[model samples]
Target: MPQMFRHRGFTGRIRRNYPMKKILKWTGIGVLAFAIVIIAALLIIPMFVDIQDYKPRLETMVSEKTGRDFAIGGDLELSLFPWAGISFSDLRLGNPPGYREKIFLSIESFDVRVKLLPLISKDIQVKRFVIEGPHLVLEKSSDGKGNWEEFGERREPEKKTATETQQEPRADMLPVKTLQVEECAIKNGTVAWIDDAAGTRNTLSELNLDLQNVSLDKPVDISLSANLDGRPLSMKGFLGPVGEKPGTGPLAFDLALSALDQLNLTVKGKVTDAATAPRFDAAFDLSPFSPRKLLDSFSVPFPVKTADPGVLNKIAAKGSITGSTEKISVNNGRLNMDDSAISFTVDAGEFQKPVLSFNMEVDSIDLDRYMPPPAEEAEAASKPKKKPDPEAGIDYGPLRKPVINGTVQIKNLTFSEARVSDLSIKISAKGGRYNIEPIELAAYEGTLKAGAILNVQKDTPSASAELNIMGMKINPLLQDVIDKDFLDGTLKAQMSIAFTGDEPNAIKKTLGGSGELLFEDGAVVGIDMAGMVRNVTASFGLSDKPGEKPRTDFSELIAPFTIKNGVVNTSGTTMKSPLLRLVVTGNANLVTETLDMRVEPKVVGTLKGQGDTKERSGLAVPILISGTFSEPKFKPDLKGIVTQGLKLPKTEDLKKALPGGDEIQKESLKDSAKDLLKGLPLKKK
Candidate 1:
């Protein structure tokens, strides 16, 4: 019994010690085996697993996928410390057939380091990815085919063999649990675009892009810089976590762009989908700069040269835009140029051919300053050259585009010497035609309303307008429009005019219209109809006092006129006053600016407002007004006066002219003597 107890105690101790010894021995063996394998791999694996030997396979795979030839001129390199990295040098991608450029893409080198342990969990964790000296060319042929689109062609799938199909179904590749990129950089890159159809070649050089901490679940910060067409541009922003599909993520960006002139712009925006059809809300600020200088910097010619140099300078704008692929909206848009301010809003649809609806307001604008000086224009026009046809240079191509509907209001607008206030215009365009309806404005102490239609569908562009003017002061209007105040009155006028031409002279020459004018309590300055008539009748000749400025005051003047082929004809333009009544019948040639008019003046019985004058009746005088607009001449109608004089007989010769003249005269004398005696006696029966 004692011996059995001792053996049991020894067996219990042996059990505890044997368990610890077995664990220690196995642990040592595992350590030794792991070390040996690692050492063997580090020393021997590279010799057998040559990456260059796989270059042909890699090239073949890329060629099959892209339908283009791909080649690696330099060897492939691999590294194993810290992380597994693969690097390639001098890679070239060939362009498709019919392209002039052989190579579409070429890279000096590309390096990528990946965390090897993440593969066990089916996670793609990249420590760093770098690209250096990459040159990419994009070209579009004359037939509108682009080289970039060649790779997108669909290819038929390879059918599985019967043996492969009979094999057991392979286990599923594990889903990616995590995808992280510590850093990615592209440096010294160049992109060039060649468009044979447009005859344009543009290049972007010195392109550098960097991304830090790019991951599937965290925001990635990005910085980009490039020289575009010799202009430096920079961008920096953050993008939110990427989703399963491209462009399905939150994005924020800021960009700064500047040109050689004082042109600078800053843009800030947030995009919901950045890769595909992005929806973005963006705000932009443009610094005050000269448009002329900016255009010159881009080697673009400016069509207009303002008379005042400062007119086109100091242009700036601030606005916000929101849009998707199909539609866009602009809000709170403001443009400032010199002393003018304009605010507008626009909603547009159909990005390819936009149809726009807009509303805009302008505080004030002086368009005269932006126009060429009159003297300069005149000088240019006087040069010896063949005149171009009126319709030769009219380009109606823009009218074929999408339609626009809008309204524009201006508080004050000045063009040349004409000033308009409280102007509002409703405009619409469609089918190669534009209409400006309900154009209302206040001008010359009066209200004017008009509508105009321009049709570009016709071979020769044509325009028609209808205008109404009410209660306008004629003196100020004439002073501004013609630089002369020929009359003063409250005037009302209405007209409908149509012309078919593309040049100013042609339009005036082709004008055809009719209108009526009425003036109340006005005076016609620079000429006196009554005095001219009296002088011409008395002397039967033209007579004028030297240095005398005569004016005719009238209670009312009414003129109804018609125009045909640039000639204005008035049948009977009448002017009524206390002293005289005058009628004018004439035609004025607008093209030649010449007047051929006849004026007839009739004297009334007595002048109520003037000093007592003998009653003058049965006296009519005809005068002729014939001259250019700048220099007019007034003269008596000598031929008509001579004819009237010859038709009338003298009073002393009336007995011979009429048979009963002598007898009537004797009877009249006897009756007059009897009446005189009766009046002296003061007797009546």
Candidate 2:
């Protein structure tokens, strides 16, 4: 028994102690079962594994479907596990005839969900989506072809059931609710619609748009805040399909945008069809907005200074418009600038419509503040020759006193006040030139109308005007035409005065016209013709009125006169006095500031034939009225008569010099001695 135990010991002991054979067999079976279960789970559960180069496959698919080249240039990645999401960095899409771009799309992350339960129920559902850094360039030629519509030939009509047509189709291959974004930005994006048939194109900018709560059946809400052509625009709005409407695609929500310190408002009207243009209703409230302020904010024609912030803040307006994408109409509006307020009722056609109608009124304004600035020659000379700055002259732009409140009717018009009357006025300028049409001015009670043209050039000043007086009151009308003094009688005449010059003095120098002067007892201030000729008689001389002082030699003078330039002539008039025929000629020198006149009279009646010796023994007066207009010098003709009077002897001494008389020397000596003694001062004793 001992020998037998020793030989069989090794095998039996191994089997009993360790159980090696059974352990090895069970271990192999367990490993094989685990491998089988894992392989089955991978295949049957539809496990998705992400591939880094996945974008190529998508590009290939899109290229085939659309018959156009599609490419993702840079990195392409795919996510696995929870949801299958694909991302393509730097992607580019191409339509051969229309568009191409560079540095396309970069999708940082995304997800995809497969619905097992829905799949079993034959329902299609998407569970995931993602987006990051995508940029697109959409362009079209001026002829009207575009990349979006480039594949028109390759597209086929979609076939669907009546029920599907009536209702929005459930999202297939896309999630019902999608939230996608992470520092998602788009650079240099563009959308252009070109109609080759019409040869028209409209291009809109492309920038980052934050999309949120995107659903197939609900409104599409988006927020856009970006710069367009250097102008910042911040807008938020929503647009979506209406409730089961056949033709209506979507209705737009109110859109609010803020810029230039002013809120610009917009609203979408009812949507009709895809074939129709997008219609909108909008309102621009300029009442709270100033054009000057807006210009300042944008830095366009940028402000030169801001010493007084309110200097450029005068205008305010309120208006509303409604129309299609291409045209708009304004209903009612009003504007206020400075002291003037204008109200308008307008009926405008399309934006492109050429004909428009408007009625406006000017409530009142201060003319002095808005008058054109005084011209400066030095300021004009300092400007550059090629593109010289404008003259620092009067600025009528603000219309400080624009009394334009009246019904203004215009079809296709050019109007001015000078043309309304016989007096013509012209308005012109270097940068601005316009000839006004005949317009009826309703500011005053009468049916007043006038037209004019003004030419205010930087280098030259010119003007012309024509004023017509209609049926108006004769008295007040004259005041506006002529000066305060001249003729007090009522005037009813058609008078026209024309001027051609820049300055007031120049204009007056060039004035020329002729008109009748009708009068009812018009009086000449200094003379009374009837009283002078009739009352003056030789017998008992002239009789004075009761309690009146005797008439002086100058007081009984009478004359008639006519004026031309600054000279006065009295050649064609009758006057009665101690003197006879009288003729006066004078020239007034305004430049030298002097007035000179010469008077010559022929003695008449008792003094007429006194001695036909032709010896001068009468008044030869030279009147001088010289000085500035404000303070003129007036006195008798002293130089002409007083100096000559001192040269005349008291009497002729022919008798004393006669040979038959007592010694002339003796007589003369005696008289002279007596006169000398009388003229000399007496001694105190």
TM-score of 2: 0.40
Candidate with maximal lDDT: 1
Instruction: Say which candidate scores most in TM-score.
Output: 1
lDDT of 1 by residue, 531-574 (tens): 54443322221232347555678889999899888888999899
Backbone atom clashes (below 3 Å) for every candidate:
0, 49
Q: What C-alpha lDDT values do all the predictions have?
A: 0.77, 0.43
Worst 10 residues of 2 by lDDT: 411-420
lDDT (10s digit) by residue, model 2, range 1-685: 8888886997789778687878888899998899778556644444354454456688898878766777766656543323334454555656555443332222433334443334445343445443444444455545655556645255577998898877864322233233222233344444444455555444445445664545445665768765544556677877553334323354645566665355465544454443355555555564345667667565556333332334435676666666665545665677777545766665444333233445665554333333233243344555654533345534544332222212443222112211122222222222333345464443222334456555443334444444443434333333343322222222223333344444444554454433332222232222222232222111111223334322213212233443333233344232234434444555444324344544444444344454444432433333244443333343234445456562321122222222333454544433322221232122111
For candidate 1, what is the lDDT?
Answer: 0.77
